[model samples]
Structure formats: C-alpha cells, structure tokens
Target: MLAAIRSIIFIPVFYGGSTPIIILAFLVALFSESGTHFMGRLWSRYHYLCARLILGIRVKIEGEIRNEPLLYVFKHESMFETIDLLRIFKKPVVIAKKELLVIPLWGWIAKRHGLLGIDRDGGGAAMRQIIKQARKAVAQGRPIIIFAEGSRAHHGQRPELQTGFAGIYKLMELPLVPVALDSGLVAPRDTFVQKSGVITYAVQDEIEPGLGRDDIRDRVHAAINALND
Candidate 1:
C-alpha cells in the first residue's frame, strides 16, 4: 500500500514538475546552447529528488569519478542510472539509440546539446557516424557514455555486449571507464513499481587505450560485472 501511494504521488509530481523544465529547456536552447545542458541537470536532479523523497530510494557512489576525457561504458540495468548519469558527469555527450532522437520535442533538445544518435541496425554507415561523433565529442573534452550491452538487462543477468562497443573503443582511441550499478533491484526494467533501496554506482579501474579488441572487451566486461559477482 505504501508503494502504491508513492507511485500515485510520484508519477504526477515527477512529470508535472518536469513539464515546465522541459519547456523552459527547449526555450533556453534557442538562445544559448548551455541552457539545455543546465536544464538537463535540473531534470535529473528533480528525478533524484522524487526518488529519494517520495519513493525512499537513496543513491550512493563508490570510488572516485576520474575527470579525464574518455569513454564511459556503463552496466545496462534500468533507467534510474540512465538519468542519474547525466548528473554524475559534466557536459557528457550520450550516445543514444536512434529512436530516442525522434521523440517529438525532446529529441530536438537532445540534439541541440550534442547527444549522438545511434543507428543500431544501419551497419557500417551507423558505425562511421558514431565514431565521427565520438571523436568530435572527445576532442571537445566531453566524456562519451554508451551501454556495452546496448540495452537494459534484468538484475543478476549478465548479457553479452553488442559488437559495436569494440568498434567504438578502437575508433575513438581513448581511455575507458567501466561503471557498475545495481539499480534494477530498485527501479527495474519495464515495470511501474519502484522499491525503496540504496543503489550503488562503482567506478572501476581505468583501462588504457591501444589495447587489442578482445583484451579491452574482456577487461571491461569483467569490470562492469564485478559488482554482480
């Protein structure tokens, strides 16, 4: 019953509060590019606030977040970490699936802020586009965030990463940071129910660039799944 009540209140408060921010963000994106970035942080903070105050969810980050321009490969568990990650990094350029770029007005704002759109099924053309955007983002000192698996997995399920991760890693030629989180235990995939619990985001060791594809893949896979083990 408590969970139900929280859901009822949270759904409205979260969306209702965000509607204005979204509008203002889009409007701000018109005059200055930084406005969208500012609103994005606000949007994430609002969600975090709702999760903590209404749903009783607490977030804890373990290990230091390195301040280097590099690629960030995160565990794909749920949307909780997805939004929270925006707040974690400074001016990150997220590589999101192509569909997200077509979401009406939100997509336009995302593009304005330099988020790269990924065409998962576009074969070679897609990879070339991703690499080009990633290279540009890195040169501009923005960290790139991508999910190794390319999609969300249920808690305790370790899925094989999509093949594109290697292509991006080799093409970008930057240090890699693997982020591990157990958010599915609280805000799970494809579910409306949110449980009250603490979610830990651990940043593992940074892997140097210029490694073989197999070696990089193996190290990142193990690092991200370490929390599960």
Candidate 2:
C-alpha cells in the first residue's frame, strides 16, 4: 500500500538523518544548555515535518494554548505526541516514565533540562522525587504536562487516570488543562505505517484548582477523551 511504502522510506530518512542532529545536540548539551534547547526544538520540528509531509498526517489544534504554570494532562494513545512536544507548548516540563531517564546521553540532557521522572514501581521514593521536581518546575514558571493514563491506550479506548495524576494534582494545586487528540488514526501505537488523517487536539477550558478528588478526576477524564472518537 502507499502508506506502507511511505513509512518504509520515511523511517530511514527521519531516523537515520536525525542521528547526526541528535549527536550534535548531545555535544551542544556538553557546553551550552541553550544550544541543546535549540537542538531539541529542531529535532521536534523535524519529526513534525515528517509526519506532515511524508506521512500525509495533518494536525488541527482547537482551543487556546495559554501561557501559564498549570498542569496539562494529554490523552495518550500513540507515541506521535512524544515527538510533537514543542508543538504543544512553548516550554513544558513533561513528566514522563522514570525509566526513560536511563536512556544514555538523552536522559542526561532531559535531567539537565529539568524533566521530572516518574518511577511507577518505585513507590514512595518515586512520588517524592516527582513532587519535588514538579514543585521546582512550577516555581520556575514552567507548565507541567503529563499523560494521565500513564501509558498509551488502543485507539478509541478511554482508560481511567493513573493514581499518580491525582496525587500530583492535589499537591501542586495548579489549574488543570486537559487535552484530547486523535493521532492514532494516522500514527498508531506499536506500528510504523501511518494512514493519512487529520489529527485533532482539543484543549478544554481550564479547571480551577482545589476541587474534590473525585470531581476533578471525573471532569478531566471526560475532557481528555473529547476527541478520542
């Protein structure tokens, strides 16, 4: 199929050609953080172009992406968003799995850039570390982003939020911004071939902080699936 062919060609160009850029990024991280920041932005933009041009995938963003130090929860269904980080926020402190912190030079760069790691299995220690990181991020005026579901779900699947999200929410007490999108239609999880489609990201209105646990959870759960269909 055309989709399969496109995927085959794109894999090498995007991934292969990106190697040098990432290495330069790593070298730049050795000296200047700003250089690394520029590299990160460049890498993300590269992926974006691949999705748009090679894969024929288009992203339609709805709603405003306000500038504020708030907790932003995005629906997780595919890894597409991982490469689209810069596109989502000007500067977002994304809370991702602690395991990712072990990825060689990349992890070092992420830690240096202040990304919070979540050790889902490390229990109390993990939570404590993430909370500390989150607090620091908020104080720095950087917005926090997390995939509330913890892991990618099947397309059209709506999963309950991981417990860690609620704890972080309550403790940080920042306003919540839930984002939903349908990137799976074009770039699905666990596969490389992509079908051309319009991926929509619907950002919902901000929810005030200090709501009851159940109330906030239910509200965000609904909002994060606004475009799941």
lDDT winner among the candidates?
Answer: 1
Where model 1 places Cα greater than 4 Å from the true spot, the runs are none
Model 2's number of clashes is 0
* lDDT string, candidate 1, 1-229, tens digits: 7877887899999989989988999999999887788888889999999999999999998987754678999998988887887677768888878888899888998888878888889998989988987788778788898898889999888898888899888888888999998998888888788889999998999898899988998899988987788
lDDT of 2 by residue, 85-156 (tens): 765666678899888889987788776666678888888788888888788878978889999999998778
TM-score result, candidate 1: 0.96
Report the CA-based lDDT of candidate 1 relative to the real structure.
0.87
The local distance difference test score of each candidate is 0.87, 0.84
lDDT of 1 at 5: 82
